[model samples]
Target: MYKNIKVIAFDADDTLWVNETYFRDAEHQFAKLLSQYETENKIDQELFKKEIENLKLYGYGIKGFILSMIECALELSNYNINQKIISKILDIGKEMLEKPIELLPEIDDVLEGLQHRYKLIVATKGDLLDQERKLEKSNLLHYFHHIEVMSDKKPTDYLKLIQHLDINPSEFLMIGNSLKSDILPLLEIGASAIHVPFHTTWAHEKISEKEQEAADYRTVSNIKEVMGLF
Candidate 1:
């Protein structure tokens, strides 16, 4: 299927290493910390809402999440949230930022196997510094021809990237977990994509059943399965 593909772009967060799991764990910690003011379910809902609202102001990654937690806590507490709780929230964000990069099963093997045959690239969205740190820690930096830390993943962004790489849309293939961010956009622009489902996905990245059904892309059970597609 990828016989004409010259560039294989990868999404670095959950696709390459553990990311949303840490966010989920942090959310649980946050709910417990603010439980005095609201139920865990309510806290989770409010936090998700706040994160979405703050996406424009803070963008993505741990720092923005931490800020949203603080904002939610203040509103939930009616501006009476304790300083200690705020400090605890900061600590949680710190721990998340400091967590070691844990690569998913077969990530290295897949990269190693394809690096020589294709122009591998890291096309992901997140805080630039954090993404760079994870990529460095992953120790697979040497494999990619380029690293694009996108602010947003849209068809236009992918078009710009394709131009920069000097490749036609038909020569590009993107692999990621999110259908909304990774697969649909690439497919919309005449590029191919492989959806490697992650065990956990943020609500914002979820797509409708009809959208998934209509998407003209291949779906794989795991990242390693991508090897068979090419």
Candidate 2:
């Protein structure tokens, strides 16, 4: 269906590899640290919800997430936080930075198949160091002709990337997990998008109702389905 697409841009995190799994695991460990102060029912689930809500206001990234965990810890512990508990939370944040990058099943094959026919670019939003490290570790770094690591995925960012790659927006295709960050803005710019939903998306990346209704967007269950576009 997308054979005319000359440039195919992919979102790195949950789209090409396993990212949400790390965040979910870290959150579970974080909840465990708070279990002693407040009852499991009150502290874990409520705090997890608070953190998710905070993500919309503060946005995603280790810094904001760590801060939310710290706030939750302090609140639950009644300002008498244990040093070891604090250390463990910080360690969880560090572990995310050091987590191994494992690409989704069939991602490599799909990219390899399309590389010959179209220009591939990776457009991901996150800390630059983290994103770069992931691309390097995944061994899929060489597949993309361009890499855009940004703090946000606004329409301007998409336009800039398309311009930088010298491709018209209509001729480019974006495949990603987040409808908010990946699909909507690109679609607003007249680009095509394929949505590959992740089971545990960060709260901030969730799509709004209005953005969900716009443009040439297609949804797939897995990354491999993206190959059908070629």
Candidate 3:
């Protein structure tokens, strides 16, 4: 069934490397910094709301997240938030940026085995500079023929990528942790996708069961299992 697939696009965050863990840590830190202004739960809720509200304005990734945290802090403290706290928020983002790349187990072996047979590429959403830096640090850049830093992963976006690769929808496949962004959109475009769910999913990426009712795709608990499919 995969014989027609010519391109294999992998999601970078969570799928290839640990990402959400850092964000979760940052969120907790932010909440603790603002504990006097609001309860931790309330602060977390407000920050999530603010991040979603600001998505259209700033897009995704660490820089946007940093801005959102600062804005959330200011509003929570009624514009009375300490400058030092604001500086600490920036530090959180910086620490996340500087964190070492911890790739998923056996990911390199999977890539190594499949790279020779397929056109492997990374299709992920994040700040362009941050993503590029991660890829560089990861030292797995040689495996990919293309690297797409998507603004948003939608059916139309994948369509453009398919066209850019000069391939039909049937020839493209996506593998990622998020069903909402990585799998569902590709399925809508008539491309194949494999779901490799990460243990912790972002709230925005979680979809209702009804949304996945009729979609057909394979799910694997581990990256190593992917090799058996190809």
Candidate 3 vs. true structure, TM-score: 0.99
lDDT of each: 0.95, 0.83, 0.95
lDDT of 2 by residue, 1-230 (tens): 67568998899898899998887888778878887787756765666676677866765566667877888888878899998999999999999888888788899899999899888999887767778888999999889988988767899988988888887998989899898888888878988988999888776567667757755589999888776655
- Per-residue accuracy of model 1 over 1-230 as CA lDDT, tens digit each: 78999999999999999999999999999999998999999999999999999999999888999999999999999999999999999999999999999999999999999999999999999999999998998898999989999999999999999999998999999999999999999999999999999999999999999998888888899999888887
Query: In model 3, which regions exceed 4 Å deviation?
Result: none
Residue-by-residue lDDT tens digits, candidate 3, 33-138: 9999999999989999999999999999999999999999999899999999999999999999999999999998999999999999999998999999999999
- Give the 10-residue window scoring lowest on summed lDDT in candidate 1: 221-230
Per candidate, the number of residue pairs that clash is 0, 0, 0
List candidate 2 segments past 4 Å from native.
1-3, 39-59, 208-216
For each candidate, give its TM-score against the true structure.
Answer: 0.99, 0.87, 0.99
| Position 30, candidate 2: lDDT | 82
Candidate with more favorable, higher TM-score: 1 or 2 = 1
The clash tally of candidate 3 reads 0
